[model samples]
Target: MPVRVVDSSAPSQVSGANPSHTSPPACTLLSVGQAFSGTQNVSSLQKDEAWRVNVRIQGCDLDHGYLCGTMEALNVPMADTPWVIQVVTFWEGEIVDMKNYTFFTGKWEATVGKPFPLMVVLSIVNRSEVDTRHWTKFPSFSPLLSQVEVDGGRSLDLSNYPYIFMRWKEQYFVNVGTDCGLTIAGFYYVCFSCSDGSINGFYYDPNSSPFQKLELKITNEGRSGFSFSSYELQ
Candidate 1:
């Protein structure tokens, strides 16, 4: 995903602090989003630096329909520089299967005058149906995730993490989502099962991955374990 530089005049805002801290930690869906602004006395050319930024994406400003990202740094020095402060805000309750997938993002801050200014960019990973137009579907598998775990541990929360799904385009496929490493590189190892039997799984994510294809070695064994293996871009 590519980040965008917003107008310094306006920035995004954050609302709805997660009291329960239940929002997925991956997207900071429940963390505080804050903005910063201060005039720096540029006595001499300063070296590159970083500043913590806040982006609040709402209906007013949206790139696609939602924003799912983490803190990123702008190369420009946060010291002795004039910058417009902004915060991109989004609804704190966006946690559902398909609806929570929409993200709207905008607003940014820019520092004036520098050898090579680098503004912290507001990057995006669009989950809108339109962006997934070219995705291919795979054979449907009813994986009974009774013994499956996510990343690690025994908890499987499909809302924030990737999971198995059945029947999308008359073919069965895995819903990797904008998450589950859509931009990740190499193969995806998926493990799941159905009531009829159990199966070992793997996925080969081609470039521009999405609606990823699934490969399952269907069998009636290995019913008490879960494992995840893959290589993702850093």
Candidate 2:
């Protein structure tokens, strides 16, 4: 697949989160992909309740799946938000909180020293079961990092921040309190603004603890636990 840079066109405000509770994820039909190795952990909420997640990909065939990238992790856990999707396109290594956007691929480009777009396919589930969600498309999105100044308009570098791990309390990882950063008056550029042009979920504090480390896991006898002993700075 040839890499192409997207134009300045704005992202179309589309629907998000499949509402059907029993439907399989969109990634299932991409390849002959079944649940490739997954890990389960006891929930921090219900003692008897457990959370299971899996990382599915087309192995060596990046050309096979609609959402082609290095990694695509998805799962349905009976939590506040029952469905979760994480996708990384060829150019962007990782996209945090992808569930927050209405679909905004037009925001990234290699011309700006960033990664280019790739063959994209999204079979996303609907409706977040969370009490408070960051899915608001426009005006309500957070702007925490978009306000930062870059030399000659460089694309944001997500590698410097910690990756979002759904295994934790979910809240602590994706939640950046409304007051965590500054918001430019007219620009509505705040610390947690989702206006980063990718998805509606880019708001964050760079130096914050939750954004400091990647998720670590250990597997044994069909169970995986957060490996607290392992953490590497992004």
Candidate 3:
């Protein structure tokens, strides 16, 4: 099936999770794409029959000298075919979350000190002739590491962050391809806001606890998808 990638143009919220209290910082959406492989063409399905999937960001802590957040997938369709979705952190080479069925969707969170790329991989197979559509969205990181100046004049590198990190819960969709095959469509959002907040504490007593009041908002303008199997950071 022919695959298409789209990026979002929303802004990132850089404050505490309270959106009603303050407006999120303006952020540019990044380009996103999906990777797939197989002999069957899956893009012939109808648009209304397509599934919608998304990942929602529940929490994040870049100020406590580490990066941590909660996430979950929503509105994924159940399939008799073998299907699985998982969160993999490249910095630690760890699978943060994994699910085999659509009913197994819920909240998952993680924290890490090392800056590296992360990703979420989904594997699905529909043996039935009937067309199926499902939508889904997941949190993702660009896997591209850049030098970021944290508070307190400390410099950190996220060059190795997972090319894809679905650490937070979001939205999504999956649908039938044009060839009467199952088409898997989804989105990936990227950001570089994970950090350890020694910078916020520099203004306070050095011996005191690090100030943990800063928030990091990461945003992208589109979505990306990937094929089943293992993916690595370059």
lDDT of each residue in 34-126, candidate 3, tens digit only: 111111112223432222222222122222111222222223233443553322111101111111111111212111122122232222112
* Candidate 1, residue 18: how far the Cα is off, in Å: 16
Candidate 2's error at 14, in angstroms?
Answer: 8.8
Ranking by lDDT: 1, 2, 3
| Predicted structure with the largest lDDT when compared to the true one | 1
Model 3 ranges with Cα > 4 A deviation = 1-50, 65-75, 81-234
- Per-model C-alpha RMSD: 21.5, 19.3, 20.8
C-alpha TM-scores of all predictions: 0.19, 0.20, 0.20
The window of 10 residues in a row where model 2 has the poorest summed lDDT is 182-191
> Once model 3 is optimally superposed onto the true structure by TM-score, how far is the C-alpha of residue 164 displaced, in angstroms?
11
lDDT (CA) per prediction: 0.22, 0.21, 0.20
lDDT of 1 by residue, 1-234 (tens): 111221112222322111322322233222123212222111213332223322211111111112222212223232235642322222112222222211121111111221111232222212112212211121321232221111111123333343322111101112212221112222222222223222222222223223332322322222221111221211
TM value for model 2: 0.20
